[model samples]
Target chain A: MKQLVIHPERCTGCMQCELACSFVQTGTFQPSVSVIKVHVFDEQASMAPYTCFQCEEAWCMTACPVNAITIDNVIGAKVVLSEVCVGCKLCTIACPFGTIFYNPESNKAFKCNLCGGDPACAHACPTAAIEYEDSETKDWVGPWAERLNESFLTALAGEPS
Target chain B: MIAGWVGKVLKVDLSARTHEVQELNLRWARDFIGGRGLGARYLYELLQDPTIDPLSPDNVLIFATGPLTGTNASCGARYMVVTKGALTNCITTSNSGGHFGPELKFAGYDLLIVAGRAASPVYLWLCDGEVELRDASGVWGKGVWDTDDMLREEVGVPDARIASIGQAGENLVRFAAVMNDKHRAAGRSGVGAVMGSKNLKAVVVKGSGSIPVADQASFLRSQWKKKASLRDSKGRQNFTQLGTSSTLMPINAIGALPTHNFLQTVFDGAEKISGERINDDYVVAHKACFACTIACGRVSKISDEAGGRFLLHTSPRNWKMAGEGPEYESMFGFGPEVGVDDPEAIIAAHWLCNDYGMDPISAGATIGAAFELSQEGVLNGTEGVLEWGDAGKMLQLLEDTAFRRGLGDEIAEGSKRMGEKFGRPGVAMVSKGQEFAAYDGRAMQGRGLSYATSNRGACHLKAEVLRADYKDPGHEGKAGQVARTENQISALDSSGLCLFLNSGATYDDYIAEFNSATGMDLSMDDFVTAGERIWNLERLFNLRAGITPADDTLPKRMLEDPIPTGPRKGMVSKLGEMLPEYYDLRGWPEGIPSQEKLAELGLEAIA
Candidate 1:
C-alpha cells in the first residue's frame, strides 16, 4: 500500500504543505486545520515535516469506539468519517504521534487520507520534503520496520523461553 | 470580501491614549491598494504641513499590510512602515518581511496609524480587535531581542511577535533601525528614531483569527499553482543558493560595487567579499518567513578563529552569538565601499549594526564619507585613525557610532550632515540627507537615475534600473525604463509582496493573487495605474516639503568621475540628459507633477 513519507533534510520550512492541507480541508488558509505539520529547529536550519504514519496496528482506528475511523486498503490511509464521528476526540489522544487531530471547526477528528492515493501536501511541497510512494519499496521505511520487528523478537527471546 | 483581507483601519493617538476604528477607504484601496500605497496616502493626509518636525508629536507613523499579506500566497509576509524620515528630510517608507504583517491581517486591520506622542516610553499590544498601550519602562533601554522577550512575558503570550528599536534609536541616531524577529528589520530612513522620539519602544501583536477571502475555492487553487510555479523558477534557485547577496558578484563584475565611498565605481578585492564567498565561508542554514514558499533568508555564523578575533577586539557586547549576515547591501556598505575585503570582518560589522539598531547602509556610507574627508585633509584631527581597508579601525568606528562615542557621534548624524560639519558640503555621496545604497551609478546609468529620483533618497529598491541597464549599458531609453520599474515597485511595495517574487511572477500574477484574496476585480492595468498614482503622490508630498527638481539629481562625483575600469570603462551617469526624460515619463511637468495629475488622484486639495 502507498503511504506518505518525508525527507526532513529537503524541507525549507515554507509550510506550503500546511497551507495546501488547510485549503483542501478547511476551505481557508488555516495552519491549525492542517494534518501535516512542519516543525523548524536549530534556528531554522532544519525543518521536519510530521504527519500520520498509518501504523499496522492502527491505534487511532482501534481507539475510535464509535467506529468512525477506518483504513482504506488502496492507499493504507487512516480516514475519519465525519458523519459517524461524535466529536469524542478519543482517537486524537490515542494516536502516539499526535498526527490525528480534532479540528475545532469540523468538530471531528482528521488525519491525512493521502487524498485518495494522491496527497496534496506532497504535491504542494516545493522542496520535495514530503513524498507519496509504496511504503514497502521505500528503502528507508523497510529497514526501519524490519529493525523494529527484530528488536521486538530479541526482547521476547530474552524474556525467557 | 472573498479575498484574504480584513478591510479595517485602526487609528491610535498616544497623547489622548484613545483609539478608533474606521473602514478602509474603498476608493483608496482600489487605486493605491495597501502597504506602501496605503502608507503614502495616510502620510500625505497627516503631514499637510511639510515643515513639521519628523520627530515631533504631530508626525504620524503608519504600519500597513497589503491584500495578499495573510493568505496562502508565496512570500506574502511583508509590510511597510511609513512616516516622515528622521535621517532624510524627505518622506520615508521602509518595507519589512516577517510574520508581523500576516498577524496584523489576521487581527483584522489593513492599516495601523500612530499619531501624537506618549508622555513616557511605552509598547503597544494588539490582539484581534483590541489595542492597548502598556508601560515599558523596564524594557525601554534593552536591545530588540530582550525587549521582545520581556513583552511576551508581560502579555503572557509567548507566541506574540514584537517589533522594537534598540539603543541607537533611543539615543536618536539619525539612521537607527526598527528590528523584528531578532534578524529582520525596517532598517532605513531612521524610522526607529521617530519611534524613540515618540517615546514608543515596541509594538507586539498576537493574532488568532482568519483572514476572510472572497472566493475561497478559487483562491486556494490559485495559491496551489503559485507554489508550484515558484518552486520551478530559476530565481528561487538563485535565492536559495546565494540569497540577495547573489547580486554582489554580478554587480561587482559590472563595476558598480561603489568602492571607497563613491570615489571609485569598482572594488579590486571584490571576489573575496562576494556572495558566493559568504555562502562558502559562513552560511550554516537557510531560513524563511511565516508561510513563505521561498526560503531565501540565510542564517549564517562565522567561526571564532576566522573573523571572530575582530569581534573580540572591538566591542565586548556582541561576543558569541551566531552573527546574522553579510547581505548584499551590507557586504557592499562595509566591504568594498569602505575598502575592507575581510568577509569575517564584514560579518562582525553586520552584527554590530543589528545589535545597536543602526542601519548598515547609513552607518557604512557615513564612515566612508568620513574616510574620504579625512584622506583629503578635511576632518578635524584624524591623523592616525583614518585608513582605507583597515578592518580593525572600521570595526572600532562602527562600535563608536552605535554608542555615539568619540568619532561615532559625528558619523551618527549621517553622511550629509557629517560633510556639512567638515566644510565640504558636496563630498558626501548622498541624496537628500540619507546616504546612497551600495550601487554606483557611473557603470549603471539607470540605477544612477533611480538613486537620484528615489523618494526616500538614494534607495535602489524603490526603483530598480539595474536589469534594464544591464541589457543596454548606454543611457538609451533608461528614463522610460526607470519610470516603469518605479511604478511596478511601488505597486509591489503597496501589495506587501517581496519584490524578489516579481522575478518569476508578473504584474498579472500579483493581480490574480490580489483579486483572489480581496475579491476585488482589479486588473493589471488598474494595478499599474495604482502604482503610478502612488509614485506621483509620493513625489507631490516631497514637492510640498520643498524638494525640487534640483533634489532629483545625482551628486557631482557620479556625474563627473568616469568609471576608471571594466567593460563599461570611462563612463559617467548622464543625469543631465536623463532627468528631463524621466520627469516627462512620470507625467510631471519640468520635474514637478502638474496640478491636474494631483487632482486626478484627489491630491489636488493638498497641493
Candidate 2:
C-alpha cells in the first residue's frame, strides 16, 4: 500500500505543502483550512509537515457515530464522508495525533485523505520533505518527537550531544 | 472584485486612534500593478506635501502586498514598505520576503496605510478581520527577536507573523530596518526609523481567510510549471545551496567588492569569509519564505567558543545557537567592506544587526568611513576603536548605534552625515545619502548608472545589470539596457513575485500568472509600461521632495577615484557618459520627465 511519509529534517518551512493541500481541500488557497500543517521550531531551526498517519487502529474511525469515517482499501487512508458526518466533536477528541479538524464552513470533519492517493502536498513540497510512496507503515511522528525531546533534554542538561 | 487582490485598503491614523477600510482603486491598481508601484500611487496621492520631513507626523507609511502575494505562485512572499525615507529624505520602497506579507493578505488587506504620530508607543494587531491598536509599552524598547516572541505570546497567536523594530528604530537610527519573521527585513532607506517616528513598535497579524483566484486551474498549472523549471535551473541550485554568500568571491575576483569603504576594489580576506566557507563550516540547515521554491535562507550555528568571542549583550532568547543569515549583502557589509575575515564574527554581527533591527550595509559602511576618517586624522576621540579589521569594535559599534550611545549617536546619523560633520563629504561611499551595496560602481559601469539613479538611492535591487556588467563592465550602450531592465524589474516588484525567479522563469510567466490570478490580460509591453509609470511616479515624488535632477549622480569617489588595486585597477565609473543617454532613454530631458512621455505612460493627469 502507498503510505504518506514525512522527513521533518528536510522541510524548509516554506508552507508550499499547506498551500497545495488547502487548494485541494478548499477551492481557494487557505492555510487555515489545510489538513496538513507545518510546525515551526525556530529555536531549533527546524520545520515538520505533520498530518494524519492513517494508523491501523484509527481512533477517529472508531469514534465516528455516523460511520462517516472509513479506510480506503487500496491507499489505507481513512476517508471522511462529509455527506453523512454529523459534525460531532467525538472524532476530534479521539484522534491522538490531533490531525483531524472541524471545518466550520462545511460543518464537517476533515483530515488528510492523501488527495485520493495522489497527495497534493507530496507533489508540491519543493524539498521532497513529504512523500507518498509504497513503504512499510511506520511511526513517523514518534521518531521526530523523540529527536525533538532528545535535543530539549540535552539543552536542559547543558551538555553537548 | 479582482480575484488575486484582496481589494481592501486599511487606513489607520495614529493620532486619532481611528481606522477605516477603503476599497482599492481598480484603475490605479491596473496602472501600478501592486506592492511597490501600488503603494507609490497611494503615497503620491496621500502625501501631497512631498517636502515634509520624513520623520514628521505628516509623512505617510504604507505596507503593501502584491496581487500575487498569498497565492500559490512560486516565491509569493513579498511586501513593500513605501514612504519618504528618514535616511535619504527621498521616496523609498523597501521590499522584504517572509510570511508577514501573505498573512497580511490573509487578514484581508492589500495595503495598510499609517498616517500621523501616536501620543504613545503602540503596535497594530490585525487578527481575523479586526484591526486594533494595542499599547506597546512592554515591547517598546525590546529587540526584534524579543519583540517577536513577546508579541506572539501577548497576541496569543503563536503562528502570527510579526514585523517589528528594535532599539535601533526606537532610537531612530537613520538606516534602521523593519525586520519581519525576526530575521527577514524590509531593510533599506530607514523605513524603520519612519515607523519609530510614528511611535509604532510592531505590526502583528494572524489571518485565516482564503485568497480566491480568477482562474484556479491556470494558477496551479503555471506555479507548478515554474517550480519544475526552477528545479532544473543552475541559478536556483546555486542560490539554494549557497544562499547568495557565493557572490562574495566572484565579485571580489572581478574587483567589484568594495573593500575598506571603497578605498580598494578587492579584499584579500574574501575567500576566508566566502559563501562556500560559511556553507562548509557554519550552515546547519536551509530555510525558505512562504511558497518559495528556492530555499536560499541559511540557518547557521556558531560554536560556543566562537560565539563567546563576540561578547554581544543580547537577550538569552537571541543567544540561541542557530539563526538565519549573513546573506551576501550582510557578508560584504560586515566582511570585506570592513576588512574583517572572521566568519564567526561576521555571523555574530549579522545577528546583532537583526536583533538591533538595522541595515548591516549602512552600519558597516558608516563604520568603514569612520575607520578612514580616524586613519586620516580627520576624526577625533576614536584613537584605536575605529581601526579596520577589528571585529570586537565592529560588534560594539553596532550595539552602541542601536542604543544611540556616545559615538554611536553620530554613527547612527549615517555615513553621509557623519562624514560631512567631520568635514570630508568625499570620504562617504554613498549616493543620495544611502550606502552602496556590495558591488563597486567603478568595476561595473551599468551598476554604477543604476546606483546613481535608483529612486530609493544606491540600491542594487532596483535594476538588473549584474550579469551584463560582469560580461562587459563598460559604459558603452549600457544606458538603454539599464533603462529597459529597470522598467521590467519595477513591474516584477509590483507584481508581488520574488526577483530571484528571473533565474528560472521569464517575464511571460509572470504576466501569465498575473493575468490568470487577477483576470487582467496584459501583454509584456503593457506590464513594462506599468513599471515605467511606477518609476516616473517615484521620480516625481523625489523631485517634489526637493531632490534635484543633479542629485541623480554617483558619489564623488565613484566618478573620479580609480580603483586603487586588483583586476579593475585604474577603473572609474563613467557615469558622466551614461547619465545623459539614460535620461534621454527615460524620456527625461535634463532628467525631468517630458510632458509627452508622461502622457504616454498615463501620468500626464498627475504630472
Say which candidate scores most in lDDT.
Answer: 2
True contacts kept of 2: 0.84
Return the clash pairs for model 2, or none.
none
Going through the candidates in order, their DockQ values are 0.37, 0.83
Best by TM-score: 2
User: How does residue A125 of candidate 1 score in lDDT?
Assistant: 79
What's the residue-level lDDT of B199 in candidate 1? Answer: 88
C-alpha TM-score for every candidate? 0.91, 0.98
CA-lDDT, candidates in order: 0.80, 0.90
Candidate 1 residue-wise lDDT, B254-362, digit = tens: 7777888877767888889888888987887777777677777876776668555675544324335454566888998899888999888888888777767779999
Tens-digit lDDT track for model 1 on A74-103?
666778999999899999889888988886
Clashing pairs in 1: B2-B213, B2-B214, B3-B213, B3-B214, B3-B517, B3-B518, B4-B517
